[model samples]
Target: MNDNDKQQGPDNGGSNPWMKNLLIWVGIFLALAVFVTIFNGPAQPAATSTIAYSAFLDKVEAGNVRDVNVAGEVISGTLKDGSKFRTYAMVQDPELTPSLRKNGVVITAKPEDGPPIWQYLLMQSLPFLLMLGLAFFILRQMQKNSGSGAMGFGKSRAKMLTQREGKVTFDDVAGIDEAREELQEIVEFLKDPTKFARLGGKIPKGALLVGSPGTGKTLLARAIAGEAGVPFFTISGSDFVEMFVGVGASRVRDMFEQAKKSAPCIVFIDEIDAVGRHRGAGLGNGNDEREQTLNQLLVEMDGFEANEGIIIIAATNRPDVLDPALLRPGRFDRRVTVPLPDIEGRVKIIEVHMKKVPIAPDVDARTIARGTPGMSGADLANLVNEAALMAARLGKRLVAMAQFETAKDRVIMGTEWKSLVMTDDEKRMTAYHEAGHALVRIHEPASDPIHKATIIPRGGALGMVVSLPERDSYSYHRDKMYADLATVMGGRVAEQLIFGYDKVSSGASGDIKQATKLARAMVMQWGMSDKLGPLQYEEQQGETFLGYSQTQRHNMSNETALMIDSEIRALVDGGLARATEVLTKHIDQLHLIAGALLEYETLTGDEIKRLASGQDIGRIDSDMKGPSVPAGGTSIPKTRRPKGPFGSPAPQGA
Candidate 1:
């Protein structure tokens, strides 16, 4: 602590804060006493009425007057029936006293022609005093919030995090373990810089966390704050910018000044790409306002005037567009990649979220995690919350496996639309279409296991067939890509075979679009085309950030472009031919699965397998079998209608 700080103590504005408060209250009490004394007078009578001067004289002559209090020329009085009245006499009433005396009415006169000298002085000075008090209060506020007052746009808006509610530690965070590990050293450096300084290893000036949105970058930063036990200042890069020029740069300077004051602290700037994008990327000069802000940030991070104890931690999903100067060795010496959680990380995340909710015994973290590939920590948290809401909606005390399934389905397949009515023929066609996808996926060795297939409308699709990976696949092989292409084309191929090409509906538009894109990626980018010779013939169609896209160089001629187009077409057609062959061979099994879907409207992978092998899956014909329930069970299909007055489920099969 500095000598000045130690000498001042915590008294702030005075030597003794309690004594200062006592004096303030004393002043307020004296002011209130004076104000009341100056304004105090006789209270107004109940229900006083204003009457004309002639009526007042008539009341007096009729002997209806009870009593009156007169102040100056204004008269207020009550009648014999206990009603009150008041009136102003513009001129002197010489006969009023005579009439009152004759009628035996009690009269009290109060001379209010002018106020006392002291009261008059107070009344006129009270307004000025109020204005002075307001001015004093404003002055006090200005002194405290000097740099952050109105017209102080240059002041930094960074908030100092308090360790109260919503505080997070390392134990609170799950997934992105790699990024968390990379940031732990930052916490160590903040807690005890001597641990590293002795070894000649000064901590990095800044660490940049690069990740996809919702991948827990901010959580990692919060964890550091919780562990470091030091001042933590958080601000967004967008907060530094303003409508006026030079404001963003000034804010950057003020923010660094704050961080330096609380040395050995952590400053987290979220979405730094907002102000640190590549200079001149936009339609402006190099010295634009945002560019100036970026320049200031760059200098403060690694300038001649050292920021010895301030460690900067910036998080952005768009690291590709950030200025290169911000990523130099003296600035962001470490780049931590917080990728989407893998299977194990996903299980940990699910378990972390599960702790916050009431989970039934039926809930399995591994099962949920295995089904959710590439979900970020935020996504898993949302999934758990949705499941809890679903359970609450059903009045269930705990979030069971059923709610989790519904939540996952809602996230993956989009929202279910049970009210979407389709004709029997349309339903049958959709069943056949999805059945083909399920059958193809099952037959392809390289394909992932089919999780579920339903002819029920969800999102924009009349039917959906979802496949879940056994484990998260890091990279796609040629065989897997081919299998994906065939699976995507299965619906279209099925429609063409059953409802001839001439009668095929445009329901396969999505499938066609997906297939075309995948095939193009494979041939043009993945080098899966023999003609393309295992080389990237086009831009990678990779992450586009900051509205920046690489200008397509004419690396290939028009002939090569045609070849690329042909290669993409060939790949797609090959997938279609493969699907056609597979469906042709399993036409009988295809018919069986389609019939099952027509009756049930949805089937899980296990159910499809059991039914395809000729097992009854809860069919109402006194034949079908389902493991979840018995035949004619309470479990109802999506498309079933009421057959009787009691709303019994339909027994008819399409």
Candidate 2:
């Protein structure tokens, strides 16, 4: 439809004739009143002439007075010619009556009274009465809507979604295969509780979905309700707590009462950690309202029977802080870890999101999944949406692989800061720094393969080097850790070699910080130090909730701490020394790669490999501003088997 047609909806002016006419007449009356008031200003009092008492008596004597009226403190009279005049007089004036009578003028006396009671009521009291009535109505409405005041704070605020409205199903969830499997039994129990009852088995009271944000915990709860065709009541943990003391406990009781009435349903409390935190946490009020709510929840969950079929599913990322009583055997019996998707799971998630968008044939899901290694299900879904948005912005018919690549980079490294420009000198330094990272990772025996290297500014980094493991490795070996540390320091080493130490910039600050952290973790937490004799120096704190505890505490003695610092430094120095040695041997290749980067700004793995290979075997280009060896000058000799900084034999190419 056209714009005009769309704007003309069914509820237009002509739909109700009386209402329309009423509005029109109201507008006309307002406009007329405003015009009169603006043009005429305020009303003027009636014109009257004031005459002195002697002149009034003279007029009466001359037979010019026609009539006189005495009312309260004033006496007024009209002349024989009908010209009106009035004057004030004392009530005790005896001449007032005699003068009028002698002149044969009509005289009348009237009692004085105030204005009518209804007039006063209308003019002064009506607006206040109307305001009081409106205030009463609003207060009543607030009481009805919130169902809370001095006495009614126990009502539950959960929204009930019937089976038909529970639109999500298992088919809608992806990338969380383990969590899905764990919930399938809950669905079956809701569908046919008799099967379990006959076997003398009781289903678990509840399942707690624990994971980082965006791992699809709440979505899985809805799918269970949809799959079982049961009623779903969802509420947030904060909803149970209130400013009043007993309100939260009352809400807990009311919610369970309602759920039991609608038995064979699901109660999903999202972010349960808000109300389920441990009692006496040494923060805030000792008698916290949240603690009371948690106590009530524990009581209700324990009272419910397995046969009741009112499954409670709670989701929280901070299960570490939940009260232990709430997570006991009878309540929240199942703990499901909905972890971030692996490579294969990411591919499936991408495919699920891709089904709705128009995409080019070259948009490979596998490649995208490989690039997004640590992404959760929601992250992958957002990645697809970002790609589609990019395509639409560029006015493309379909989302292409190029858009996905850019979108991935935007998510991983942040959006490119095209406005952030650098001088030629800065650009050259960034290229060489990134090139150093790629070269070291390429030659390091235990390092992952380099994915891409770029000197373009993205987010806070002036350059980036991406490396992806060929396959997922659950455990890190000592050699691999050393290799990773050396790779991190490669950028700094590269800057020091390409430009003298004085010319090096702070771009390697992040690289140095990461390398230091890894070294410290290795010595103190991972027990990788030979001097420390594989004894863990760090103590772990208690898990806040869900029992997923593992934070390091440095509780060692002063002497031990000193030993740890020395060990960390030893590890970092060793990695840097190895990186420096390898770079020195491949200094020619490093300059050549950096030169190529200056011209291209970015390079893929294949291009990097080709550039590094080109400089080998004395294939020298004299025009290039790099080290040129004479006929007899050699490069690494290819047979000088020496240990790399990671204490492993360097790769043959290096």
Query: By TM-score, who's the top model here?
Result: 1
lDDT of 2 by residue, 480-537 (tens): 9999888888888998997898977777778878889899889877889999978777
Candidate 2 regions exceeding 4 Å error are: 1-132, 140-153, 162-166, 543-559, 615-654
TM-score of each: 0.79, 0.75
Alpha-carbon lDDT of model 2:
0.79
Candidate 1 lDDT, tens digit per residue, 579-618?
9999999887777788777766678888877766656554
Clashing pairs in 2: 319-545, 319-546, 320-544, 320-545, 321-544, 321-545, 578-645
lDDT of 1 at 232: 76
Taking all chains together, the TM-score of candidate 1 against the true structure is 0.79
Q: What is the C-alpha local distance difference test score of each model?
A: 0.79, 0.79
Where is the poorest 10-residue window by lDDT in model 1?
A: 645-654
